[model samples]
Target: MSRTELLRLVFAQIFLHATMTGLRLAAPLLALSKGYSAGAVGALIALFALSQIFLAIPAGKYADHHGVRRPMGFAVLAAAVALVLATAFPTIPVLCLGAMLTGAAAGITVIVLQRHIGRAATSNAQRKQFFSWLAIAPAISNFIGPFGAGLIIDHAGQASGDLLAYRICFAVLAVLPLLTWLLVMRVRELPFEPYDPKAAPTHAWDLLKSANFRYILFVNWLQSASWDIHSFLVPILGYERGLSASTIGTILGAFALAAALIRMALPVIAARYSEKRVIAASCIITVGVFAIYPMVSHAAEMVVCAIVLGASLGCVQPMVMSLLTQVTPAHRQGEALGIRLMFINASSFLMPMVAGSFGALIGVGAVFWVVASIVAVGTPVVGKIQLRDNEMPPEKNL
Candidate 1:
């Protein structure tokens, strides 16, 4: 594909992801407006991740067998329908259902897109650069989606409950996926190459059984959990601190903006440090950031934390993608990406519910401390990651 074609695909992914981020930030506040407790809100978040956990591998398999075009089209359309559902119902149950549909759609779309990019790249350098650029779309979308949602909610005076402002947000979000669907239609479809039965690794479990791949998956899970917790807890934390919806959205947006800025510089950073070292350092910094996140009561303080956290976490995705593609066979890239997502989404599915309960009983502050402890404990595991070959070039003086 030409660079223009790739960019168009990336833009569609951006819109779809923005919709997901907007919903993620808005859902809890919407539920809270309806008098739901923290625990119930957590369940709502779990429902989203739960659906992805179940469908991820299957979605990957479909992509591997049928190619990405059809799956991408379906996923975007499903997301559009999901946003419309949430807009129409404006209830906790319906919103939960919408979350599931959105998650499933996102899971499929992500694996397919990653596989598409992995296949298109001609070298490790290009792969790193491509995936880093790919990561930026979501980072940018994360900023636009949540920040926009918060602005809409605050301006429309609908932060309190099931109100017109929230519905309007959903309505606007629905347009993004529809546009993605149109873009997917315009892109030339790649021909599908059926998975060869004679291939060494026929099953997803076979890849999971490899010690190196398992370690990568575990590291991904830890990072994924941290991402989930930050998204899930920050809004609630902001609400508790008496921050407005707009301020909370901007804080989250700042985090995402920092992430985007770091991602754009990842190629330069990878030139200086090994992907393994970068990832390990990021986890350690993340532990420190989480330790301080709970204590901050002011919006400005939270934005500072968000920037630090975003920069640290932002270094992770491109490295992981670079490493994952290096470790896995070319033909099975789709399945491997799917399995990786399954592990992450499984954590996403479980952690929010646990955190929610803890938040309900103990406090949201305790939740942050627990997340910090978990990341700290996992740092050594990140240190142990031994890729068979270093994909990045040796450090060069700037």
Candidate 2:
């Protein structure tokens, strides 16, 4: 991908991502204001993945056929409508609708953008470089959307506490998709050979027949689960040990910052490290981090462990995205990516609940050890990933 095209795509990604994330932050706060319980809020948050889990495959297939612009156009519309609806109504039910729609829109946008870049990539290294650059979008938006929306929510009202603050936040988010439209709409799609109907596989699940696809998915799932464990357990761990909420948030923030920082270095290192080597090292390091988390007591020590965990898990996605394209056929690249996203979202959605149950039953520290043990056993499976080729971004100045 040219620098200009990559720049546009990255900016587009930030906007689309920021809209959903900002609304995600706003919606729960609004619901809480309207007398919703924590469980109700959890369900409201769960709606964000409703479409992502079920529609990921279809959305992927759609992108494969239509390319980026049309799919992204639909996403932008859905996100805009979701936010506008939430802004106007500001009810629990309406916010649920908003979460589902915006989540679906963001999910579809990711599928197409990754497909577009993967299809356009000329070499394995280029694919890695591109995905490394792309991977930071979520980390950046994770901060941007929530931070900006919180600022608006706190100060938009005449007073510090007002429902109108949330509505205004939603209104601001509603316009972000328009920005996404302006950035992505004009980018040229790659010239693809006509997809032949007869040659296509009978079902998306047929992809699992490839051992390579299955192994890549397994590794991807494990890393994704590791991420979930940290997000879910850390708060509990911090609470049990009497760490303050801000300290807990700071620790998680350290993880996010470390993940983003590591991706920045991935492009420079792409030429030196094979995806397999990077993935294996990431998994092993995650194992070590998991083992360390329960033993950490001081705030600074916990933050250090969190950053180490973040750096370890951050290396997996760019490598996984590159491998997903290599292990599947060209026509089905979108489908494969879709499957990967679907699987990861499904895992993300379910893993938290599982960790909660495990935390309640086994205690937080044991939960960490158990998950670490599982990852240790599974680390070898990453080495099982055989690929048709290597792929990442060009090692140019990125």
lDDT of the structure predicted as candidate 2: 0.87
Off by over 4 Å in 1: 25-39, 86-93, 150-168, 188-192, 195-201, 228-254, 271-273, 287-305, 352-377, 380-398
Query: Model 1 TM-score?
Result: 0.78
Which stretches in model 2 have alpha-carbon errors above 4 Å?
Answer: 159-161, 193-201, 390-398
Q: Estimate, for each residue in 263-330, the C-alpha lDDT of model 1 and write its tens digit.
A: 88986887667678888999888999999998888999999999999899888988898788777766
Q: What is the C-alpha lDDT profile of model 2 across 1-398, one tens digit per residue?
A: 69899978988989999999998888888778878899999999999987799989998887877778888999999999988888888888888888899899989988889888877788898888898888888888888999999999988876744778887888999999999999998899875544467764547787887777888899999999999889999999999989999999999999999998998888886768888999999989988989988998999999999999999899889899888877777767778888998998899899999999988888999999999999999999987876656542221211
Q: List lDDT for all candidates, in order.
A: 0.81, 0.87
Give residue 19's lDDT in candidate 1 (0 to 100).
83
* Per-prediction TM-score to the true structure, in the order listed: 0.78, 0.95
